[model samples]
Target chain A: MISLKLDKKLDSSEGEFLLSIDIEIPKYSFTILCGDSGAGKTSILRMLSGLMTPDTGRITYDDTVWYDSRQKINLSPKDRGLGFVFQEQALFPNMTVRQNLAYALAKGQHSKEIDLLITEFQLDGLQDRKPATLSGGQKQKVSLARSIINRPKLLLLDEPLSALDQKRRMRLQDFILKAHRDYDLTTIMVSHDAAEINKMAQAVLSLENGKVSRITRPGEMKKVSEMTSGTITKIDESAEELILKISLKKKSGNAFQEEYATGEMIWVSKKM
Target chain B: MDWQPIILTFRLALVTTIILFFVSLPLAYWLAFTRSKTKPILEALITMPLVLPPTVIGFYLLVAFSPAYQFGGWLESIGLRFAFTFPGLVVASIIYSLPFMVQPIQSGLSNLPPSLREASYILGKTKISTLTHVLLPNIKPSLLTGIVLAFAHTIGEFGVVLMIGGNIPGKTKVASIAIYDEVESMNYAMANNYSLVLFSVTFVILILVYLANGGYFNQISK
Candidate 1:
């Protein structure tokens, strides 16, 4: 288990705000830090990864004291066993994909494991290519493989799939899940996509104004039906299928989609 | 007509560039990432060479390198003297060409995404390893720019070299100083030869740097 009681003072373009977080993250669970923009989600992830230090509080992982203000003990990020996938992939541009992964090899990892990772991530023919030569999805795959080569105890991902299209996103999501399961890493990710959170996260921590305003298990959280109510405005049957356009409540300008009959009211929140 | 000054100047520039390459690596890295309150002051000091009159820098270095000062006396006792010698010219050249060596590397490091460093740290790599294996390699263009600029700038130096090393032949007289002497003695033919050679060499180096950087003008235009 990783326990944290941390506080930080931040000055943003909006104004100054206090980020006071007290939470426990369970081991071997996929935890998602879910919030709107400027809710301190990325800051929390930085704190966990030892990229940023809390102003005052303690952070402990299992038996190791990662940070303790009272004891003046704060370990550098190098001393903390962790892995991070940045939003931009952040692969070393000068290194080939194989060298990138090889540089991250932890002690006791065999050379065969590098080959296994290259094959598992579907980076077969691109091992010798630099990051600039690879496509977006390929870069992300290489980045993920490099991060986990060390088999970190904790993995932190900062919206690793935000830039890809739906088709590619889904494919990479499966790869991510497979890596997580195979490594059994305690992963914490920051994301705002509700469907992604619901599908992947075991627990969600929602932040509002730099505080954990709500915590919910993915199984117990309210589904799309409870959050959105709309009226069906139009129906299209041109493609040999029925599709309804919904005008949501209080926002009449935008229309959404759900399976419904015209002139009927519907509660639809799932993205089309 | 003498080629000695040309060879000596090249030797000095080569040594200065090589020494500064290693010295500026760590200094540039620190300037790129440090959050210390004195960072602005340090940056200003490092960059002072860019704007300060070369003669002023030469004057100060001359005083410091003189055997009268404690620092210079200590150095003299250790069998090293900087007054009007080849070593004096090198010391002056390094000081005069510091910004050329440091600025590009610092900008290269600063322009990289912070996530790169953070990612390396999380991978459990030390700062030195990350710098050597990751940061420096990725900034090849900038490193090349720094080295070429330092070399060319040192080769073209006149005022600092004149003030600190004087015009001693075969020991401290460099190409620029030889050019000055040829011009003063009304030896236009010799001066022209030196001028043409220096101009051709600097031009070729600049072209090579541009080519190595994938046509710097094209990148800017795009």
Candidate 2:
């Protein structure tokens, strides 16, 4: 299990606030941190990855002390042995896709694993190309692939698919899920997308009033209100069950409740 | 016509550029990434050469290099002398041209997305490896600009070199000094030759850098 009691002073345009949370995540669980923008979701991921330090806190992951306040011990991200994929892709612009994956290889590790990753991620054709030459989806895929090259046990994903299109987002989500299970990773992803949370997370933590609280499913999401209007952008009849793809005013998610047709206006209410 | 000055000038420029490249890499990295309180002070000091006259630095260096001064006496104890010498000229040139080498690199490093470094760190790479393999490779244009500007700036130097290295033949007389010497002796033809070479070479060097960085060469190659 991974446990943390983190305290950090934060600044937003709204003003200064304290982010304090005590949380435990079971090993190999796909946990998602859900919150609004500037709600300190990314901050939590950064703190967990040792990218950001928490003020006077203790963090331990699976028998290893990642950080401690009194003991004054903090492991560097390099020694923490985790994979982090930033929203920006953050691929080394100078390295080709193959080299980018190869870079994450630990000292004395085999190079053949890079080729396996390339073939697994279906990046074989693009392996020799630099990041600057790749499309947005391709770059994100490469970024995700490069992160797990070392087969790190912990993976931190910060809005990894937020920038992609609807189709690319789904494809990238599959890639993430595949990596998550295939590598037996303990994953913590920061995302506000309800459908993503529903699809990926086994346990969800929502930040409210500078604190983290548990939420079971997307049904309890504040974003899905008591009643809302949306146009049915797509109606998939191919599946055994009918699925309506509705585009709401502020956000979009699949409304699996009732049968609907394309271009139909419908009212969506919070089930609970 | 003594070609010794021209040869010596190129040699000095080469040496200064090489030394400055190595010295400024770590310095620029620190300036770009450090949260230290002394950063502002060091940054101001590095940039002082940009605003302050070369003679200001040259004057202090001249005094420091003189065997009469304490700093110079220590150097003399080590069998080194800087007053009116080629090494003195190199020291002066490096100080005068420091900003040219450092600013480009510092800005380049600062402008890269922080996530790049963080990603490398998460991949368990040390700072040095990340710098050489990732950061430096990504900022090739900035490196080229730093190297060329430092080289050209050293070649075009006159004031600091004149103060610390007073026109000693085959020792401290560089092209700029040679141009000045030729013009003072009414040898306008020789002066014009040196002037033309400096102007043309610097112009070509600058144009080439811009073209390469602008992706003109890439376009052509494609």
Candidate 3:
């Protein structure tokens, strides 16, 4: 199990909002962090990968305490046992595809394992090619292959498919799903595509203004609707005040009406 | 045919090239990655030797290494001499050809994306290892260019060598000085031979550099 609890300030936002979040992920589950750009989704993943530090947080994976601000203990990225795939696909340009994957494997590991990964990713024909010669999708595949060669404990992806075309994105997504299942690895993918999240994520965490709202599977949207009540009101394009309406059941068993502006998406929740 | 000076020139150029490689690697790394407030100041310092006249540098070295000066006195106490020695000539050549070595290396490092270094850092490699394995391999062409330029520049240097090394016949006399001595005594044939050899060597080095750089460009374009 991997658990993260953070209450820290992030510079990407204007004011110091409650960027606090608490999440518990079960083993071998696919979790998606769904948010728009600059929504702290990448920041959370970066902290988990040890690329960035949190001001006040405790992150533990199984028996290992990855980070604990109170204890002043933090592990380096290499020791974190996490595989990270960046948005830009940061492959070493000087090395060939085969050499790149070979470098990532543990020392003394068999060449047959690398050969198998290359064949699985369909990079065998281009093994001798440098990254500069490969197309976008091919480069991304090589990057993914390199990241997984060591078989990390957790997989962290930050918009790895955003640079490719739609077809390539879908193809890579299928590969990611297969890898997740085959390795039984805990995976966390950050993305802005709602459809992609809906398809891949067993659980989605919506981050808005640095706050996370966890939505589980099985009638997740219905629960969200109930929590927000009338806050899901659509935008009234013709309104000057950006009006919203709320229907409440009073003690008399009758519905009561309350109107609010569109800015009240935060206040209306079933659990307060 | 007296080949002593030619052999001496080759040795001088080889030594100068080796020392400059180590000196320029860290310098280029700093210029490429540092965001310090004094980066411009440091860059200007490296470039100062490049733009200054060779004679100016030679004059400074002459004074700095003279027996009367503090640095020279310290060296003399340690039983090491700099003036009129091969080591002195090497020092003069390094200063004269420093920019030729550093500029190409700095440009190569600057062209690389920071993402590559960051990725390596996150993957458990130390800064030194990343530089040796990842950064050096990527900038191989630029390294080759720097070495060639430094070697060629050191081979053709005359003013600095004359000032510091004093043109000792078989000791400090380099190819350029040999050519000068041949010309001064009206030995046109010997001068012609030396000039042709230097010209051919420089031309071949340049051709190799161009071919290497062109190969990289064509591969990337494809």
Candidate 4:
């Protein structure tokens, strides 16, 4: 299990906001951090990966303390034992695809494992090619393969398939599922796509204003009423009950209206 | 026809280029990656030599190298003297040509995606390893440009060398100083010969640099 209680201050053109979240992630589950832009999804990923430090926080992974602000202890990213797939697909431009994978290998891993990954990712003839020469989908595949080649304890993927086509996305999703289960990786994927969330995530954390607004299982998400020409925009929950706001200008004449128990969608619904 | 100055100039250029490569690597890394508010101030200070007149720099360097100043006195205490020596010429060349060595490297490092470094770190590579293996190889054109520019700039220096080393024969009388001395003595033939050699050497060095990394410029120009 990975646990974190973090607070970070951010300043942007939109204004200042605090990224404060206290959460625990179960082991070997694929959890998706679902949110809109600037919702601090990437910030959480960075903090977990040890790429960024929090103002005040304690992050412990399976009884190993990763960070504690009061103790002034923070492990370097190199020591965190996490695989990260960046949004930009940061392949070493100078290295061939094979060399890129080989570079990511941890201490005891062998060269034969890289060959296996190369074949598994359908990167046979492309091993000698540099990243500059590869297609976008190919590069993303290589980035993903590099991340999991080391069999990290946790995998943080930041929109890893945003550049792939529809067909490629499906194929890679299968690969992701196999890798997650086969490696027993505790995975956290940052994505806002509803279809993707439904296809892959076992659990979803809905983030707003740098906090978890709701956490729901993918199986529990309710579908929106397709007959109604309206979109569910927000879901507000209280101790009493759940409130869903659907944007229905045609029916209600207002931009949005809150309905009690007439809810068609949950927060971060798999059924968009 | 003193060939010693020509040889001395080449030697000085080679040694200075080597030193600057080591010196500028860390400095360029810092300048490329640092987010401190004082970065602009530090950059401006490093680049001051590019705009400042070499003579002014030389004059100040002369004062700084004198035994009277604290820095110079400290050097003297360490059994070193900068004034009127080959080492002094090297120091002068490095200072005058620092920006030539640093700017291209800084620009190269800055042009790379920050994701490259982040990925390396996430894969458990240290900053030094990432720099040497991942970053340096990608910035080959910039490294070549920096090395060639520093070499050529040092070879062509005049005012700084004149102020600090004062044209001492075989020690500080580099090619540029040799040309100046020949012209002062009314030896037009020797001066012309020196000028032609220096000019040709510089032109050939630049031609080689451009040929190897010329495509980089062509792409930028487009």
- Ordered list by DockQ, greatest first: 2, 1, 4, 3
State which docking tier applies to candidate 3. Answer: acceptable
* Steric clash pairs (candidate 4): none
lDDT of candidate 2 over B119-214, digit per residue (tens): 999999999999998899989999999999999999988889999999889898899999999989999999999888889988999999999999
For model 4 chain B, where is the 10-residue window of minimal lDDT? B213-222
How many clashes does each candidate structure show, in the order listed?
Answer: 0, 0, 1, 0
Query: What is candidate 1's lDDT per residue for A63-165, written digit by digit as tens?
Result: 8999999999999988888889999999998899999998899767788888999977868999998999998888999999998988888888999989986
lDDT, each prediction: 0.86, 0.87, 0.81, 0.86
Model 3: TM-score, first chain: 0.78
Worst 10 residues of 4 chain A by lDDT: A261-270
Top-DockQ structure, candidate number: 2
Cα error of candidate 4 at position A217, Å: 0.3
On TM-score, the leading prediction is: 2
lDDT of 1 by residue, B1-222 (tens): 799999998999999999999888888988999999998998898899999999999999999988999988999999999989998888888888989999999999999998888888888999888998889898989999999999999999999999999999999899999999999999999999998889999999999898879866666677
Please tell me which model should have the higher DockQ, number 3 or number 4.
4
Worst 10-residue lDDT window for candidate 2 chain A reads A261-270
Pairs in clash, predicted candidate 3? A227-A270
Better by DockQ, candidate 3 or 1? 1
TM-score of every model? Answer: 0.89, 0.90, 0.79, 0.87
Task: Rank candidates, TM-score, best first.
Answer: 2, 1, 4, 3
Q: Where does model 4 exceed 4 Å of error?
A: A222-272, B68-70, B216-222
Residues B1-222 of candidate 4: C-alpha lDDT, one tens digit per residue = 678999999999999999989999999999999999999998998899999999999999888989999989999999999999988888888889999999999999999988898999989989999998899999999999999999999998988899898978889888898898888999999999999999898999899888879685567677
Q: Candidate 2 clashing pairs? A: none
Candidate 1 residue runs with Cα over 4 Å from true position: A225-272, B215-222
